[model samples]
Target chain A: MSVTSLDPVRSELLAELQQKVERIQSGPTAEPVATHPALSGLLQLRAGGVYGVDAASAALLLAAGPSLAGAWCGIVGVQDLGVEAAQTYGLQLERTIVVPEPRERWLEVVAALADVVDLVLVRPPGPVRQGEAARLAARLRKRGAVLVAWGEWPRCDARLTVAGTRWEGLEQGHGRLKARRVRLEVRRGAAPPRERELWLPAADLAVRPVEAEQVRRVEAVPDPVRVVS
Target chain B: MSVSPPLRTMTVWCPDWPVMAALEELRPDAPVAVLENNVVLACSPAARVDGVRRGMRRRDAQARCPELVLAPSRPDADARAFDAVLEAVEELSPGVAPLRPGLCALRVPTRFYGGEAEAAAVIAERIVSLGVWDVRLGVADGLFAAEQAARRAAPQDVVVVPTGGSGDFLADLPVEVLDDPELVSLLRRLGLSSLGAFARLPQSDVHTRFGTHGALLHRLASGGDPHPISRRQPPPELVAALALEPPLSLVEPIAFSLRTTAERFVADLAGHGLVCTAVRIEADVDGVVSSSRRWAHPRWFGTADLVDRVRWQLTAQPAHGPVEAVRLVPEVVEPLGDHADALFGPGADEQVERGVARVQSLVGHDGVVAPSVQGGRGPASRRALVTWGERADGVRPAARPWPGQVPAPAPATVYREPFPALVVGAEDQVVGVDGRGGISCPPARFRAQQGDPWQRVAAWAGPWPVDEQWWDEAAARRVARFQVVGVDGSAWLMVVENGQWWTEARYD
Candidate 1:
């Protein structure tokens, strides 16, 4: 679908993804990650900004590409992030590490991870204090790591909200749930927001950009001439 | 230039180090023997007093000392524990050269402590303070003479050869001191009972009779080093420093603060076209260096790996005081080009390494695992899972030809904990396998537990009998595996043993 026609969530995600791409492109390295061009911008985690993601599925959709393309990604304190679904999204299970819960040491844990992990997907157990968030942001920047927050994060570089979702495989409750289409809204730092629609999990378990189908010509009236008149 | 003997080298020897390390956690006075291939390799003094000796068969040794605490020879364990001794020696000297797990050498620092004898006493005192009561220190012109002097010294003592007197000192020693059975026996047959006799043989005659080994032995007996010391290149100028503000008390904060420094440390190594295989980390609590440790990495330390080591070192214990400064030193480095990228190009999954590392840090190291295939007949036993950054210890060799292993197309999912299930026939009776490896009935339904509804089984295969460790009654298992496909397209490998059914693995 056209970027504007996407539901709010997808538009926001698209705008954020585009802003990352623009920033990476303007820098010395035009192409940040060479393996997965589809995830080039998403993997170039700019320092000092916490980027928010709306759903685990949407997060995996953005993550799987870069993860498979050699970027180290971690899910911290995200209890229900399914390893199986993550594998389906093309992530090599061998390389993925999931920390379901990090209670009191959440900030320290994230900071330690920021040193090594290229991208960290965190679900803050509670609202983080301003100073704590700022400290985390500064660490990420210095370490050149990206923090992908599952919940709202203050002063985020970008935010992607999942607006709508549709599953294609279920046939009246008989068939299994399979392919999923999601609309993502992207809001980047001071950039005009945009949208994108994608298969959150394509038939083959890879995220794919969705293209609008060509509008077919139809006759509203019984006769074309009558309709014209 | 005047021909001069090699500089005097000091040797520190820890007798029966493997036995000592093996019994480190055990009673200090226990009689112990370390075995290799069922033969005694080394034994404690108590075992020796009990008539147990090295080279004795396991049975013979046990007969000699029934209460001997026998242990397998663990070279790696010995080396790992001996790191403490190395560190202790390193505290006294900067250029320590480790000869083996129990022995090390360093140039005698006569100027620092007045003379070689005083230098030996200083080192012995340092090691004794570290709780190694039986340390022996020896100083001589060559490494061999020094090692021999250390071996002959009484426990908790030092032996120093007078300057340029190693040749005179080694003359009367038995030829067996060389420890080469063939040479010793041959020399004895030739009526040469001492090193002096062997050394007196014409150099050309010794070369003609005993070849290179004999010539080398002659040189050693005449007070020459086996090989001239090739001094190492001075350690590279690579140190990353971080000065903490207000000195951090918590390990996590110290680790967090040093993240940038660690990254720069790795980057600096990379800039010099080098990769560090081993690194030394030092934290200054106050003005003086408080804690220092050397860490070896399985792979060259990347930015994250270096940071992980720093965190591990810091968190291993809470510092007595706030950490004021931290420094990273590359202990061992290799040329960057030595590690050729994979021929097919790097795997896109390098990100998963970071993920695994992060999870390990949060969960305290054992939280995340990568599954590996290993040799075994059972579905659960065939899969080996290893925590990240650790070697797959205890894994059965997958290369061996296991006669009755479960045939592949291996299961997609192996339950970490097997689930008990009911395999029933049409009559609602539980399906089972008899002792003769025959099925009691065809499985028609499968239910996980009593309350769960029985799901219709679509297709079935196997009843493959696996009788493992039949001779070991307590460890024996007799099971028949059946691959049953459910109506929902899910397939499971179920086992029937001792009238019990278990869901072992799943195919997704």
Candidate 2:
């Protein structure tokens, strides 16, 4: 063995230690799952990580990627998730299982679905406790599956929030809604929030990044503050 | 070996029996027509008298008979209804061959009923006693001549051709009795206008000119029996029933006790080279059915699946009192060979199904669902959720262009039930939609509930009219929709129907 190298007579011992450290860091990892084309540059979804989203649409968007890539997905505790929107967002409907209103046993349902499906999207009945999330996280790492939570969670690898939304095709009273643009804020561990402008849906029913100067840009100035003391 | 002649055959016919079976659902006097593919298959006598004929389009038939009620042709229902008639006829004859739903054939009795005419009359009287009118009977030397005679017999009457007189009996019948219009027209042009004339032609020439089908028809016209009627074997009694001694009320005890019966049920079906895919389980409490449900399997069911269906049914709707008996009736059974596993097995679907079955066991069956889209205008009506592990039946097709449907991008959050909301104008008057698609006032502020804080409207669009099922008064719906953006940059899909406003979905 080289003098500077850590390898010794028992090289297997170093390998064992390496595995333990990797397990502590993230337990285990599965193949990387595809993300929405619009978020490809902004986000890379890895197995064994739970992502939290403020809106139902964002959760649907996260699941759509893996689902469209021939992966099985399960939805728990979301009774009103529009399936048409999910399909339009690129999820394959035939592979999606929805457990609406899982009431008191939602965590168990998520755990069960985690073992079977590649992706599980659950809207917890209430705010999740830290220990429960850690337990679920261990299971996720062991099972090599991803969890997308639509509501409050104490432990998350990242959080996506819809900071602002703008409708483009509607006027005062006559025109029907045709397209939408949203300002998204992505927050990760101890980092400054990253802001991105994207089309939630374009006039042609496509979702992608908004192009520069295609339409007149509005300043989006904040309204005057009103306070009564 | 010599081929044996088919025994002197008798055919019994009940005219318009498909229409008769469908008429069970309507008033007895209502003229009904059963249609398949918009063509009248069979019509009641009342409709017939009004010029509603078979093979006519439904619109034409309805025009001919203004009060004719229409029903889609249900072959299974027709078969089920005719099963009773077959059994009634079977009681008089040991071996009966069913020709179709409305017709059957049997050997003309020589000993049991004494003579051919006596047997025909006895069978006719027996069927009429079952409340099925318009049954006619005919006896001849062969099945073909017998069927033709049955067609010629009047209602509640029987026609008997003298012994070995099948040819003379069918002589006067036209060549159209062959029932192939093309051959009938050719025969008519060839100067053979009746069965007697066609029967007089040389058999070898007819065979050379018209092929085997023509030769078979020539033999039939000559009253020579070549086709033999095969009698139907009665279906086996496969229902398994278990009586709970001392009447157990708890689901666990009932389930535990019924295991042997479930095993036996599966075993019996296997013994007959069949597998049940759909079974109806019934729990009887004090002689009354307390809980009954039909469970279906994507593939054929096994012992465990049968047991699970029994347990789930009992658990879902518990018996009010102790259950005295449990019965399992197979609804849809297929040949075992059709459902056998392939050499390579079913692959990934089997694994996924097992995993889903585990989830279903944990949360009970209906907790998991598969989502699909259906054709409708309203957000709630457009989406359909089917319980996992069950067939999606009777779902309205989604391919039709549903006018007035909410445009995409569809709302991500659709409320299962409309959440009540208040939409008001600048004057605080509640906004409403009139019948003619006019808004009483433009919506200015809205709140989810009465005590919740109101949010100012930023941008708004309006009044996509939806009027559904207008002809059905009780189920009719009239509504208008609006897309309103709140000051917080959130958007909502609000609906107004019957002077009330509700939030139906969120653009979130």
User: Each model's interface RMSD (Å)?
Assistant: 14.3, 3.2
Per-residue lDDT of model 2, residues B1-508, tens digit only:
9977547889999998989887777877778998887899999988898999988998899788877888877666577688888899899887898888999998887678898888988899989988898899888888999999999999989888776799898889999888899999999898989999999989999999999999999999999989788877666899999998899988887888888998999999999998897899999998999899888665667878888888888888888999999999998777786546533664445546656776787788788889998888987888999888766654679899999988878888888988789888978899888878998888778875555567877788989988889986768988988888777667789888888888899888
**lDDT of each candidate versus the true structure:** 0.72, 0.83
Global Cα RMSD, each model: 12.9, 11.7
Tens digits of per-residue lDDT, candidate 1, B1-508, equal: 9986557788999998889887787888899999987889899989999999888999999898988888878776677667888888777776778788899888888888898778878888888888888899888888899999999898978888887888888999999999889999999999999998888888899899889988999889877777543333456789889999899888877777778898888888888888887888888876888888988663478878877877888778556798899899888777776554523554334423543554465567655555445678876776565555665556788789887776544443466667799887878788878878667777777775456556776567767788899985668988888777655445567888888988887643
Kindly give the stretch of ten consecutive residues in candidate 2 chain B with the minimal lDDT sum: B342-351
Which residue window of length 10 is worst by lDDT in model 1 chain B?
Answer: B346-355
Which runs of model 1 end up more than 4 angstroms from their true locations? A1-229, B1-7, B18-78, B109-134, B168-194, B226-372, B384-396, B415-434, B439-463, B470-490, B494-504
Docking quality tier of candidate 1? incorrect
Model 2 error, position B321 (Å):
28
- For candidate 2, the per-residue lDDT at B19 reads 91
